[model samples]
Target: MEDVISLSVGEPDFHTPWHIREAGIESLEKGRTRYTPNRGFIQLRQEVSSFLSRHYGVEYEPESQVLITVGGSEAIDLCVRSLITPGDEVLIPEPSFVCYVPIAQMAGGVPVTIETGPENGFKLTAKELEAHITERTKLLIMPYPNNPTGAVMEREELLKIARVVEKHNLLVLSDEIYAALTYTQEGHICFSSLPGMMERTIVVNGFSKAHSMTGWRLGYAAGPREIISLMVKLHQFAIMSAPTTSQYAAIEALKNGDDDMAYMRGQYDMRRRLIVDGLNEIGLKCFEPKGAFYVFPSVKSTGLTSDEFCERLIYSKQVAVVPGSAFGPCGEGFVRISYCYSVKHITEALSRIRAFLEEL
Candidate 1:
């Protein structure tokens, strides 16, 4: 009862591995402190290109198709800014990561949110995609291996969406930061991997999730040469270059970090099953998540709104889970519980949640 547990944040609990840290220190020791090319260090870009092809079967030329950014967050902002014009509509599925809609709005684009519920496994269907398109639709922010809900679009599902995307001639900002965390029957699928979809898809991925390097602040985007170049131009003005130390470390990560990723994925998979089973046993309905480290469980049966449940839990039980409504309107009636903590912590947190619900 004395221990406090928090399940609110989606970040790896693991420390950045030793070799990657050493790579950063080595860069500083060698005085490799100067500004890298605006696009990023050439070596890092090459590594990213290779990593993508090897892991996801997506190909891109290092010199023309990659631009390293501060994080996946910045990569997303740049993609939206470069493509969206005033009054252009960008399709977003909820409950998704929070930044997409705001970034689109900041770029003078209209954000049209489509609600995908638990009944559908939180996936945005091809029918939903087609129904939302119009002449003004310019971009679709594809946040799969999704954040709050941890939903993933399988290859067949992505192909269905690709058909709609092709018919509408719209651009796709595909965020695959959590691709390595998929836990469902099938692994994650990149929309860009589909035939003809690469030309229209801007892929954003980072080492934060996979390499446990969030503090390193490194990520990259890849796409057609023309789009990548425009993003680089904007990146040059906005962020002279990504952090030099992080770039050096990222090189080591792409080259030697695959084992580290596999280890973390296995741990997450165990924690995921524990939390999902525990929640269901306590009468909270949780949709099994196929990717990412968070679980979205409905709190409606407790007769408390998502916000009310989260507030009460934090104050009374010393447990913190984010209200799903904070992500978007469609997220109402659910709360997001992150599995990024220790297994013991997850066990204790769920027990407290169960006690709280029983009291209701």
Candidate 2:
């Protein structure tokens, strides 16, 4: 624990940009602390709508199609519960974020895992989706610019997926939490922006990753007004509104935070290259991640399970990283390292990881 270098946290090391924080402070100073409507402040919702339309060409009616929640996790839960029924199957691609399966199960839906791997860039294929389809299958959770693995789905690939989704009449829970952090030249493509997909997808995005506002606890889901109405009803009973200050902060973030996000993304891109190269040189066989701030490298060469590798690394070298298996079983031979820390932090962690590998 002493002098340990951690590359485990999937959060930006950057502070919320001054202007955005100032807005929150200004809101409080102005005595704007009363409870907002259950669906959140209408202006924030309108800003979210404008942000989505301008950035990704996905348009939603701010009044009825958007529901703000405590965070992306809450938005995701609302989506699952709003659509899933007992005995229905929810298709999830793994190794991904840890929440989807549990959320679906809690909604009385069965979680069906579809394993994706490096051979296909960790993307869910149309063939795979078709194969998994059954009468009981009701929803597909599309987590792109994915967590843990840092894989991104391109528009062409998404088009293929959309075809299948339309054919099967399946609804998609498109989690775009990391959409703004992609490394591609063309940038992120909103799934709902694809033709015929807008009405079929619930888009979940938040300020936590892009604006470095995880502590703010704010997020929103936009989609068909019918589905959003259900989620809003649920949110009203469970959570009255997202944090008032956070909502105020997020308004500023959406309006003027693009520069801040881009700056942080550039830093993360630099760190991403460093860690990927470092792990490969250390013989960990890392895949170059194209999005998000994490690298998932195989630890199989060390002749250890993912859990074994992470535990041994932590105890022996005081370096902490998460075992990929914690995301899903298909992740068993890998470990996830976050590049959201500083260049110095990532460099030192890489050095220690190399030393640890040499010891083994």
Candidate 3:
């Protein structure tokens, strides 16, 4: 096909807002290019602290509970490294973002994958979580508003898991990068907001998804002071500071980017409904995604594995989507369709997928 559609990419389609770009440009022109403090620029950290507390009701002291990293990815790495020792077990719910397992492994920890399926709405249930815990379990990677599945844990659901976590004495590494993209009627609820959970949870969030600044590489982690200190020490030796221009741009994002987020979220929300509805209408079983910009639809009816389905669709129809199996084993019969494209692109892609599946 001369023209193709891709639903595999994850970043927002919108460009960084002009004012945020201008802030970065201003920083560059002013020769503010020196390395910031290892933890991060104080102003940016303060802005992040305020943003988290204001938006998520999680209070983090700017000086001690926050550390700016290269991105949410690096923040995750720091948490796993700071908390995991050799042979320690990290519990990860499957059909998740791909980085958690390898990062835990690189940190000298073993990753134990728990299969979470559509029957549970792809959520990590309290019983499932409790079964996975042992004295060896050191960390749990809570990735919701999830990446491929777009599953979000509301407050009630999180509270159930928190009770189990408290019983097991587990430390949680919560990835909230997509918190701003949740679509449920109740909206997104951070695990940190649950009672008795914030003290034991390390939260990773960023401007990438919320502010359309992925390429800028600005993200941060917030938690108790002691854990944050260890993360900062690791950050100090590994990387002295995050990007200077990105940090300046992030300050602008925190201060004046709410409108931009609302506009972008409105667009993604529209596309999210369109794609999920279209997939269901096409005979694919799509779990209504309540958060993030992806639709994880079951392709089992197509008589093909997730990888086979993706390959055939890409080759035959020139519509690219990622195989859900790439996320984890439980994702075998599904595929992740990202809504980070234009409306026209989403419509065309869904149309092509429909035609392709009908042929089967």
**Best candidate according to lDDT:** 2
lDDT of 3 by residue, 96-151 (tens): 99999999999999999999999989999999998888889989889999988999
Candidate number achieving the greatest TM-score relative to the actual structure: 2
Per-model C-alpha lDDT, please? 0.93, 0.93, 0.92
TM-score per candidate: 0.98, 0.99, 0.98
Q: Model 1 off-target regions past 4 Å?
A: 1-3
By summed lDDT, the worst window of 10 consecutive residues in model 2 runs over 1-10
* Cα error, candidate 3, residue 223 (Å): 0.6
lDDT of 3 at 265: 89
Put down candidate 2 lDDT per residue, 1-360, tens digits, no spaces. 699888888988999899999999999999999999899999999999999988899889999999889999999999999999999999999999999999999999999999999888888999999999999999999999999899999989999999999999999999999999999988999999998999999999999999999999999999999999999999999987889999999999999988998898898899899989988998999888899999999998899999999999999989999999999999999999999998898888888988999999
Ranking by lDDT: 2, 1, 3
RMSD of each: 1.2, 0.7, 1.0
Please identify model 2 stretches exceeding 4 Å from their true place. Answer: none
Colliding residue pairs in candidate 3 = none
Give lDDT for model 2.
0.93
